[model samples]
Target: MARFNRKGTTKVLFVETIADPGYMPTATELGTAIDYSKALAATDGWSIENQEIETPDLASTFVAKIPGDDSAADSSLTFYEDDVDDDIETNLAKGTEGFLIWCRKGRTAGSKGMDVYPIRVASNSAQVSLDNEAAKILVKCSIIDRPLQNATVPTGP
Candidate 1:
């Protein structure tokens, strides 16, 4: 297998609602999602952690360990402030519930992807910088659940 850089491989889409939250969204549903790939500057967090259970029994000197429930960490998306349209700022308001479809290996057909249906909330407000830097806004997402992970990218119409 050949190694490739992640330069032009990520795609982020924000959708207001999903017909069924139990299953992976269809291609038609993904197509209607608002594409925020261009506006996104950086992404932080979204780590999954497993609860460790330690069993210290008198039978053995070592403690037996087991994994318990899994939890997803909160994530943040930093988007370049678009003063001309203000699209990112308007849509990603606090208390907004939406699904964030993140294509880690590009959204092309047969590629790997992950869909996270998280509620949008404000983490840190946009910072104003006097130095030569692009103004960016951070949008926090509380991941309540994950509908799909490491799924194949479906072909879109």
Candidate 2:
């Protein structure tokens, strides 16, 4: 196995249209997607967890538990504030729906290290610090359905 750092190797894209959220997108489709890797600062909460259902009976001393409904956890992306053209700000506004493509091992073709998530922007808020720091925007995304995980990166146009 190869050990590597995630910094400078992650690529994030926001695609307006994807025929199928559960299927991997083609190279042509990925080329048309909007690339937001440059403005991104941080990411969090793209995970899944199951609810535990406990079963207790009068005759049983130990409580039995089973997995219940699985759900996607809240996810968010932090991007550096951009004023030019207001592209990222406007597109990622509240209630905006799109496909979020995250390439962990970069966007190299034939690499199976990509995940495409169909998400709707739940909220978008600005983060301004009083100290010397760049302004940022936090975008909360709600996963609409099951995402395409561990997919392959297509060739570039």
Candidate 3:
């Protein structure tokens, strides 16, 4: 078995206006990807939730249950305050802009391991203090829909 590490993982955030009311943008549609890893402290964080529901039934001791709603995915990307730019700050502040979070591991032709998440910024906040060694900005977002696994790598302009 082989083990994987975060050494070669590349994370990018593509900010764009939502063209359709409920659609996620594809990689090709996004231009000039922002190399978020430049300011990122570590690999982009991600999570998923499958809400549960229970049904009442008198005949059985255990209640009937079923999965509720689509699985919701959320993530947070923390950036070093010094490395972030004004453009990113302004975009994030807009709150209504849509973003495509792209991750790829290894750059070789056959080593394409990619994942893309379409998301909307849920919150934008920062941590600053005289006592802390470095200031940091944390952008939290919720997935607009299912992620595009093994997505075609987006090209740059």
Instruction: Pick the lDDT winner.
Output: 2
Q: Which predicted model would earn the best TM-score?
A: 2
- Cand. 2 Cα-lDDT: 0.87
- Give the alpha carbon lDDT tens digit for every residue of 55-80 in model 1: 89998999999998888776888989
Off by over 4 Å in 1: 122-124
Ranking by lDDT: 2, 1, 3
Overall lDDT per candidate, in order of appearance? 0.76, 0.87, 0.61
**Candidate 2 all-Cα RMSD:** 2.0
Better model by TM-score: candidate 2 vs candidate 3: 2
lDDT, candidate 2, 75-146, per-residue tens: 999999977667767999999998999888898888878989889999999997898988899999999888
TM-scores, one per candidate: 0.86, 0.88, 0.68
